[model samples]
Target: MSKMQPKIISTLKAYSKDQFFKDLTAGLIVAIIALPLSIALAISSGVTPEKGLYTAIIAGFFVSLLGGSRVQIGGPTGAFMVIVYGIVAEFGVAGLTIATIMAGIIMVLMGFLKLGAVIKYIPHPITTGFTSGIALVIFSSQIKDFLGLKIGEVPAAFIEKWAVYLKGIGTFDPMTLAVGGLALGIILLWPKVNRKIPGALIALIVTSALVKILNLDIATIGSKFGEISSALPKLTVPEFDLVYIQMLLPAAFTIAILGSIESLLSAVVSDGMIGGKHRSNMELVGQGVANIMSGLFGGIPATGAIARTVANVKNGGRTPVAGIVHSIALLLILVVFMPLAKMIPLTALAAILIVVAYNMSEWREFKSLLKSPKSDVLVLLITFFLTVLVDLVVAIEVGMVLAAFLFMKRMSEATQVNIEDFDASEEKDGVPVEVHRFDSVDLIKVYEINGPFFFGAADKFISALGELGEKTDILVIRMRHVPIMDATALHGFKRMIEICQRQKTKLIISGIQDQPYKVLEKAGLIDVIGEDHFFTSAVEAVDYANKSVKAHKSGIDSRVL
Candidate 1:
């Protein structure tokens, strides 16, 4: 029952041979699906193809062994492609290793600190915006390979990258484009023919065979990054100084936040499919360990892949065993089939990544979000544009701040302060009746506050009280509808008390809720305003104020006599 317990440990208690067989089948299928994707994502991320397999093998194995979700299949995913590529470009692979390890540490800390639930609150618009932006960026990054453009290193900036692509448009190799087209066509159309087999795998095999048989002069994995390594590279500690750590800290935080979001989202999706609950904190811990191991093993950053996890669930995978099998199966493919990867055309991988970009784009969601409220639309568009035109870090940072301010504005509008006059007449049993009409009604002012009294609404509270006339004998604040209060609202109340004291006016509070009462009591405002002046009902407080005013007037008359 502990939140830190891995789902594998719980599921294994009731495990059966039948379920193990099912898990095995599903795992092998997922591994097939992951193969071309892992290679393509790695190449797209500015790393060698073998590194992607390293991530899938190392990170995937650990995630399955220790994850909180029964069917979460973890590995290198397209969502991380943009950020990972940026880190690799800026700091090189060594820098990326350090950042990834640092990110893993942060994730572990987040899990232990019970911050898993908080990460889910990231605004949907921001997620969608950046995702769509990243998709476009990924698409842009692959243009060189997709077209076989004779270009040197592509620029990192979005605009500059496109400019370079345009300049080299004349140098595109027709054979390479044909290979990419064939791969893209197979990927898009293969599901209709055979749903069980992964389209990317078929495309990889068909395109590679065709290119080799024809002896096309297209750039292949071997031509660009050399042969894929069949063996895992020795684990090495990333060398770093304080300057690199400080410079990479923000990048590391980005990776942690992004990885946590993607992995938890995957776990949640898998949980729904299987009608199971996942330990979110434990999932974070698992992902943390996986990423740390991935970095040590010369792998790119990794997280739970939603598509693969969904495939696992649909293929009868009911436990983490399937995920574990997926990793093992991929490793076997790496050690046995890695040499064949050398002949796979780069254009085919580019086509696969293009599909990835399309899936990641979420264009329909982006369009729907455009029709949302203007504030939401603003946040979405700004985040999207900033993500494409600038850095993802800047986009997320600005979007969060903008969303927070807009949220405060909406909350301020929702909170209301109404000046109430108890002068209305009502009919009782066909007879006219007066409700709380008193002689000193004009002297007693009542302001009823509605909604939470927080910093957002504090100014409104003060301004509402400013409407009081100089001749007011008493001020009563009705807080029945106020569910909570914050320090800012308490400060406003203190200032109100000061004004009442200056005007020699009696202050009374009525219908205060428990939360606001505690807030006032903690701030010593209750004592400052006199506890005797507080009432449970507005009518009772008004009656007490009337009597007090009458007694004060009588005292004035006697002194004059």
Candidate 2:
């Protein structure tokens, strides 16, 4: 129950006036950065721009107050844009809301279960793969806006999307192109001129100003979606339907997964920056709650935004107060200046997303991955193409499976078997004698098998054991190097024991410890061979074998006529 709730009730202190000033500056900057992005992302996601502000206000505030990270800023992110757009298109806002709520509940449950540590288990390569793929998808989705191309219906598949894009190359909106290009230029170049102000906000302001003053025949948000609302969102519930729920489940799952990944990644990044550890499960729960609230209030899906989190850190924002302040700033702007938002151009928002897609691609990492081993490269490429062409869910499932299979293969290959002449004969007639001219009466042969005894190497072990000659009095199976045993090897061990019993020879186990010993004990190998026959070392087994052989010889001598 404690795990389900926030660990600390009160907020951390900023410690200095300078820190407070920095927090205020940083909060304002991040809010400025978030404003255009929230609206642009909302537009891209097939929702109203005001809903985006609503999300940044309500969801962003709650996430910070209850979140694990000290500086994480939660809101609508590009990661959810594709999935959210699909959900809204198919199931409408009501269905999307319900799905988001369902996902939120799942996240709460995940937090209570304390699955924070489990985030580490998600492979780095897999995350990079899907992230890069989503980047490509975002980039592709924006081609229509960037080039102002007109296509009747864009295909969802990657190959088809490109085909449609290529077909519409002739019909480009020149004014739209100019606006997008200029916006991209400002966003890229603004940081060099001023470090404090966000580039995206600058681009939005400049581009919107130009479009309005010049009276360019370009598509503006107001022209397309009408005037922006200036009031806070009213709480509402989605009309529940089994079919809509079923239809939106995939989108919901994508949001949930992407949210988990992004939020955890953001938390990790902030942890590194602030020298503090974050509760991953708690962060996930916060994101879930944020998203649920955002949906109920007619907003888009929200998660921890990496850029905003970094901004918060850089600005000396040491506590959740900065995050709360950021929400307040957005709320103030939404309520006071929503009328002015109508003047923003759609091409400007599209340009923002175009920049977003470029950043998200992580092309440098993609190039580095090209040099990785074949297994990793394959998984990466497969996930990338699947995300761009097929669906995020499909890409994730296939990538995970491939990664797991490759991991198991590597583990299996570590186990090995070796064969050697344990029992030898004298050079009788130049033949390495059929039976060993033993220096000791023990006549115990030792064969050492190393590595895990999984199915991969079980066959080799069985074949090696099968080669034992009939003259052998006893075989000492040395497994000091073996670390693990699986059912397949256990079955092989049973067969080996039976073969020894049938040949009227004793089978002794030596150097068994840890997992091998436990498995052997559970499999009844010790019971069948008699616990006394199992030795801690090969020398002990040999000594036992010698004693048994001497006793047998004495018994035989007694029976002689």
Local distance difference test, each candidate? 0.89, 0.79
Residue-level lDDT of model 1, residues 1-561, one tens digit each, is 328988899999999999999999999999999999999999888899989999999999989988888999999998888888888888899999999899888998888888889987889999999999999999999899999999889999999999999998999999889899999999999999998899999999999999899998989999987767899556888887899999999888888998999999998898888899899999889999999999999998899999999999999999999999999999889899998999999999999999999999999999999999999999999999999999998998999999999998998899999887756443445576554755587787888888989999999989987888878888888887899999899899988988898887788898888999998898888888888888876667767877777877777531121
> Candidate 2: deviation at residue 298, Å?
2.4
What TM-score goes with each of the models?
Answer: 0.95, 0.88
Residue-level lDDT tens digits of model 2 in 23-100: 787888889889999998888888888988988988888788888777889998888877777777877777768877
Candidate 2 ranges with C-alpha deviation above 4 Å: 1-21, 243-247, 420-447, 455-473, 522-525, 545-561
Q: What's model 2's TM-score?
A: 0.88
Error of 1 at 416 (Å): 1.5
> What is the C-alpha local distance difference test score of candidate 2?
0.79
Off by over 4 Å in 1: 423-435, 556-561
In lDDT terms, which candidate is top?
1
